[model samples]
Target: MHIELKYGNRKLQGEIPFDAQLLQPCIPPPAENPALQVHRALDRPLAVAPFEQIFSAGERVVIVTSDITRYTGSEIYLPILVERLNACGIADTDISILIALGIHRPQTEAEHRKILGPLFGRIKVFDHACDDPAQLVELGETSAGIPVAVNRRVVETDRVIVTGTVGFHYFAGFGGGRKGLVPGVAARKTCMASHFSVFNKAPQTGKHPQATAGVLDDNPVHHNLLEAARMVRCDLLINTVLSPQKEILGVYAGELEAAHLAACEQVQDLYQPRTERVDLAIISSGGEPKDINLIQAQKALDYGCRAVREGGTIVLLAACRDGFGHEHFYPWFDYQDLAQFEAALRENYQINGQTAHSLLSKARRFRVIMVSEFDAEITARMGMEKARDLQQAIDMAHANLSSMPKTLVIPDGGLVLPHQFVKVKTFADPA
Candidate 1:
């Protein structure tokens, strides 16, 4: 069977066995006009007053946006939102755009211009520097002990508007909503505190019971993020749900928690696909920037882990063009002994260190075959087998299975979550 997988800015074609189950996000047809939909959503905000009524003239406004790593399509929506804010009598000088970079690398001027489009020339734009103590303003702590230090610009402004795309975050339930507050504009210590909530004292176990994807009710990381957002009083939130190709399927606007939660419930069905367990899984990390680095691409591996049975094999396809996304993550791979690494992680756990633990935890249950740009040495050091090509990766995975195993192929594993199944027994009486 011939199939096409998303690669960076292109498609990768390969042949797999016809029997391999092809899993994909159940994204509906794209909206007739996504840009128009966004404008309409802003006009009729959900559960809150519209922009004009919400703010008055002479008020300083701070627009918080996701940075480059997050594919929010700010260029598409920022201009429209800015125009609306202007119509509300907010002057150009009174408005500022803050990129919620969190602890990620700061974006270049060229990249920022590209993300903001024409607005780059007219409005003042700045990237949040989480490490810079001067740029952060202390906003007291949540009851859970998270010291909430947000960007000074956001706290000083009269109104704050958060804009970002919505999707399943590997840990924090779903992305969007209060995320723009906790990690988006938060100080380094605040971000670390929320992230640490995902860590388990016993790192060897690999899973944080409350940090699993698609869960929120009992999720400590998510709940704390919400508390931080509320503590700062986010005025309005504009979040979008997109297709695998990053088309806007739905636009949500209004009160921080209400609008985001509504969008999550509305859009999750599009990404969750019900399936039984499989022995061998072939997965892609939704291509391009999603797979731009091995660290970010680990999200797809987690999704694949959900579909594959115990002692199964997962063949992952990612570009990883940028290598490991975070500098701190590479060293964890040097610890050859899993027990020793777990011991070290427990002693001194850093933020990105969790990614290494997650990788090792998944490796213990399933064989991980990685096909990427990383050299064999690096791949081996990461505790994964390197594959020369897609077919070679598949061949290696098949070798580990007994007989022709039940195979599953996820075109965009990052977005397509597998649903758990319940067993039912049948009884019959014979004559």
Candidate 2:
């Protein structure tokens, strides 16, 4: 069968076996009027009062949102939120939008305009500087001893509203909710401390089993982040569930944890699809922003790998026009040995190092053939075989397999997570 998958801004065409299983998200049609959907969510929020009832005329407001890397339909929802604040007798001067850059690079003027939509000039927008000590305020510490420090603007604000899209996060359970506050606007040290929880304590140096995709309970990383977020006073939370097409499918609003949890459930229903394990999987990291960089594109690999059998082949299509997401990201690949890498990470951990570790670990386990802008030599350094195009990648996969293997193809691999259904046999007991 002929198939076309997204690669950066373009699409790559290739042919696969006729019987190959196609894995995709069960995305419902986008909301007819996305703004109206946001309004409805605010009116009927979960476990908290409506937005109008919570904020007063005199209160200063700050809305924390995801940075440019992770699109959250911010352009569609931010206008409505600002309008709602205006309706509550709060002037635009009293409300500011804080770009939750975390440890990411600052956004350009064009990026800022895109994030704020129509509210770009009307309301002030500030970028969170995680490394700037003057911009952060110490907020004590979580019970787990993770130091909590966040943007001073958020801490000083009279009412704080956290907003982002919810999806299957690789390690920290799900994105959105407390993530908008903790790593979003948190200090660099705070971000590192919370994320370090992904690893188990000393003596047991590997990653914690529970700190993985689609899990929240007993996820030490999630718990630490939530605890750090709790140190701050967030008045409301507004999270959206986006379709693979980047349309807002559902909007969740109200209390911080409750509203975000509701969004997470919506994600599970839409993104998680059950399938039988396959010997080969062809996956794409969606397109454009999703494949803008290698660091961001790793999510697609993480989710799609679940559908493949042990020691199977994965043809990952990621354009990565922006190169490695961070300058520090590529250096982590220098530690070729998994044990040595883990030891180094344990000694001095960086989030990018963790991602590199995850990527290398997968590369070692699976025969990952990546179709990207990265050169063959660069890809080889990270333990992956680089192909010039999708057709070449498909051909490579076939060459690696001993026989005509069962295959699975994921078009929007970044958004969709495929879970293998293990059939447990039940024996007939004494009748």
Candidate 3:
């Protein structure tokens, strides 16, 4: 059968053997009227007061939003949020946008305009400078001994309204509400400190237990992040759940935790699909921007890791036009040994370093093949075989496998949590 998977900016066609299974999430159709849904969410918010009730006239409001890497329906929702604020008597001039960079590099002007769309020049738009001490406001330390410092704009603002899409985050349980406060606007030290708590030398044993995706109760990372959000007073949280195509599926608004939890449930109901393990998994990071770099594309690879059988091969289709996508990530790939990688990460501990560590952790179990625009030499150094295209990737997979291989193809790999729905039958279950 012929299948066209997502490439950088376009689609790449490939052939899957007739016997191979083509697996994808059973995603529902997009919300019929996204704009109307946004308005309805605002009017009937979850646990907090409405937007109009929260903000008064002549107040400085900081609208914290996710950066370009996250596929938050910010372009569609930000304008609506601004309009809601406008109706609440807050002028456009008084409202500002702070792009949450965490430890990621600052976004370019083109990206800023692209992400915000209609509201780019209309309001004051600023990037959260995580490294700059002058821009951060210290808000004391969490019980876990991590210093909490966030962007001063969010902290000082009379009302901090957060807008972003919710999805299953690998570490922080879920993304959207509290995340926009912690790593979104947090200082570099704070982000590093909180992130460091989740790393363990033995990933297979699940030593990083609290860091699992879709888990909120007793999750240390989420707890610390929510503590920071409370410190900054996350007054209004508007988080959207997206379909595999990045279309709005559901919008949850109002109180920080409640609204975000509701959105996370919606995501789980939409993204989780039951599947058996496959010997070969052909996965894509859902095209351009998601595949723009190795760092962002690694998440989809992780999803593949969860779905593929042990010792099986993963053929990852990511454009990776921006190369490794992080300054610290490529260096760690040089260390062939896990101990060496972990030691270096513990010593230096950069954000990208963590992602590299994760990649290495997965490499321990499964073989990964790359089909991207990245140079072959670069991916080879990272212990991944580079294929010119999808045909080459499939051929390489066939060569690596000892027996007939069953296949699973995830077109939108990053959207679904494959790990959650894998069937694990106990001895007591009926055969």
Candidate 4:
């Protein structure tokens, strides 16, 4: 079968077995008018008062949103949100937009323009400086002892609205919701502390099993983030669910936790696909910014590997144009031993280190052949084999399998989660 997968800004074509199962999220058609959906969602919010009613006139309001890395349909929603606030007697001067950069770098002027769309220049926009102590306000700690320092602008605002797109996160269950607060505008230490929950309590125990994707119940990472987010004074949340093509499918607005939960359920129903385990899985880290760096691209690897059996072969297409998302990320690979890596991570916890650990762990379980911008040596250092292209990677994977293997091809690995279907026998079923 001829298959085309996204590789950075371009597409790579390859041939797979015709019988291979093509996995993709069961996305509904894009909304005809996404802007209208945004308006309607704000008009009738879930579990909270209307957007206008929640805020009084002349109040200082801040809309916290994801940076350029994770597009939240902000261009479509921010203007409507500003218009609503304006109608509520809030002047443009009293309102500001804070980009939840977290530990990421500040957005460039072009990037900011893209994120804010029409609201650019008209409304003041500031990037959250996670490392700047002067910009952060400590708001106590979570039950799990994670410090809850957030951007002073968000904490001091009269009304805070968190906005982002909802998607299946590799860990912390799902993204969006309180994530816009905890790691989004949180301090460097707060972001690290909240993310450190992904690891087990014991040193050599590895990552907490419950910290896997598409889960929320008892997920230590999610719990830590939730606790930290609740420490802030967030008045509303407006999260969107996008189609695989990045069109708005649904807009969820209202109370923080409740609204985000509603969006998470929709993401589960749309993005999680069920299939039997396959011997070979070919996956792509969707395109452009999704494959912008190894840090972000690893999410597709985490989610796509679920469809492959242990010791199976995986052909991962991650452009990684920006290289390791962070400078500290690649160095973690120096500890080739998982146990040693865990110990090092425990000694000085870093979010990038955790991601590197996760990447190395997957490489150990599966023969990962990556088609990316990284050099062969870099790929080898990370425990992955580098291929010049998708076809070469496919040939390498096929050569490793002893026989003609069952295969699964996932075009949008970053957005889709594949689950193995468990066979159950009932009394009425044939034995």
Candidate 5:
């Protein structure tokens, strides 16, 4: 099969050999991190599963995952998820699936199979369906002027399991909680409403975690998510934190509040992206899967850019393992020499401008360097100063570097996803 792959504003054609085997998910398998050993070390301290938790003695169980799950692969919490439920005595037959689509297109059966992998015929796999735009049901409005509505399928399920990785989210305090319900199952009005506040554009202090954490309680968007999860009687939440290799380093399962908190702690251990001030920041998705989609790809530039000095540069390291997911993002990705991508935002067609306006907004002060296994010509047009290798990106940064007087690097930018509650660094700085 011949398929076209695209990055920002660039496309390539490739032929998958007729006999080529499809890729399979292989969890890197983590051992343990002592500082993060609370769950295991304290396993004895955890309460036994409640006999009548959620579904009761005889009822159905349904599992739903975050919309962030990708096609290349994700450590789909299937085993850990199922085993947890089974330990509580729930049968597999009573469990099904729901891939939260959010505002994105519904998962094709093929994509579902990948997300479902072995889940094909064994489990009654399903995806969140709200194709008829009118079907979204409103639960209520939040104090933030955001309306809250949810997919009826998730709402009406006998007992629902919410699953997602716990990482620092741009708006919400963490990614696993109410977000899955908002954009995942909640009506667009509620999703748009909660987001209608001044959250997304809030200034991010390059080195301070406290600045971000302080805003959480006042965040209208976050409050909306908590309110909705309660309204639906969300049974249990299962959240994960992946290692640098994307292994499930930690799993938080149980009560809604506790589960999320546990996952956040794990997230803080690995992904606390803090840098006082740097002459240059070298960042990237650390290659495939994480770098596969631009939606997920921009994170690297976002963090690295903030930590950099004025007129400093961010050299992004990405093989873009899969390339950009949304086709519309490709055309807007040119103009390499400039420190900005303004035309798209100021132009007539902002539809194509969404990605640029966003990147430019995030990348205001610093220049960007893109070194990847991607086509050179296209990346050049996308406003990224192209480089051939990791060292070269650094060399380029070093050559023109400015006053900040230091460099902070994240070898796996995407894997370093942070959670606000993870707490700030202290002992590391003896100064």
Candidate 6:
């Protein structure tokens, strides 16, 4: 019996005993319908807390949410959250929406309209400006020593409602809880500190992050986020977990850490991918996000790294309109090859960013192919191959595959990663 294995453009067909197997049937771990418990998750919030306790009749409350873009695919969750807020008697007019722009570019009017819809026209809607570098209001520092500066509107508002997704994160353990505040509404320097801050200490990463495995309460990063939210007087934390097809899995609201972690249990079950051997992996951003930023783009490296071979290829399919997130990250990934480039940046910390440096420290080794309108020629110079089209790249890889290469394919790159679905293995066979 012979088994075919793929490593990027090459494939290896190895002869095995009849008892040995190659092709494996993969059934993504099925997640229980948390939606049935959705009402349960919120039962305490709605049933216990009175409307005026969280908000008042005439007070202003801003609902901070990520605008509909390629990342997070937050359109569905945004409205569901607002409807919940409206039911609390927080009139739509008193509600203002501030997209946690973070380091990503500003959201356009068309995107804003589509994100909000026609239901609540009276609410004021705006996006956080991280590029301004001017209006930043630094509140204080976190226990981790990361400085926190949130948008003035966010702090000035009588109350704040954070809306985001909960999933596995490379740094800061996980996403959703305090994330919307730091990079979402925090200033440029603050966003830089919050995001790049992960580089200060090496992250614990392997096939799985033990620290990131469970929900937010136990995660220190989540705790740090809670502190940041407390500084700005965050009243409510609303997070959602969506299925592969973008269906609502569950919603966890109220207390930050506990709620975020509860959501992660569900998100990890769905968004996590499952594949053991992958020489070449194809991850698409699902073409849902309007534009892919380096911050959101980092998911590919986090969850997808587990499936790749020791020396393999990782093709990230995203539209990174903003290019390398921070000026500091360019020199990190910008090299003749990741090896030489990473060495230079690590040896000379003068050029690398905080969190970007953190990522380089963990990666085993893999090449990234930027396959969107991200100034392809420029990235090509830095060793990252730029593909004109997704199919074209795949065709080229197929053209170069070995006689039998074990290949793994992940359709929606944004939501899935190699590590999420499969356990990583040591690659010693070069055949």
lDDT for each candidate structure: 0.81, 0.89, 0.81, 0.89, 0.55, 0.57
Which ten contiguous residues of candidate 5 have the minimum total lDDT?
16-25
Off by over 4 Å in 2: 422-431
State which candidate, 3 or 4, has the greater TM-score.
4
> Distance from true position, residue 420, model 1, in Å?
2.8
State the lDDT of candidate 1 residue by residue for 222-261, as single tens digits.
Answer: 9988998887767899998888878888888899988899
Task: State residue 317's C-alpha deviation in candidate 5, in Å.
Answer: 2.1
Candidate 4 lDDT tens digits, 1-431: 68889999899998764357778766668666998999888989999988778998999999999998897789999999999899999999999999999898888999999999999999999999999989999888777777788899987779999999889888888999999998999999999989988988977988899998999999999999988898998899999998878899999999889999999999989988777788888999998778989999999999988888999999999998778878889999999999889999999999999999999999999999999999999999999999999999988998878566888888899899887774212112332
CA lDDT, candidate 5, residue 127: 60
Colliding pairs, model 3: none
Regions of candidate 6 where Cα sits further than 4 Å from its true position: 1-43, 46-53, 70-90, 131-135, 200-223, 290-295, 319-364, 367-370, 374-376, 398-401, 419-431
Write candidate 3's Cα lDDT for 12-116 as tens digits: 888755346555666767657889888889889998876678889888899888888887888888999888778878999999999987877899999999889
Compose the digit string of candidate 2's lDDT tens values, residues 253-365.
98889998999999988888878888888999999778889988999999999988889999999999889988889999889999999999898999999999999999999
lDDT: the better of candidates 5 and 6: 6
Count of clashes in candidate 2: 0
Which stretch of 10 consecutive residues in model 2 shows the poorest summed lDDT?
422-431
Model 6 residue 244 CA deviation (Å) reads 2.8
Q: Candidate 4 — what's its lDDT?
A: 0.89
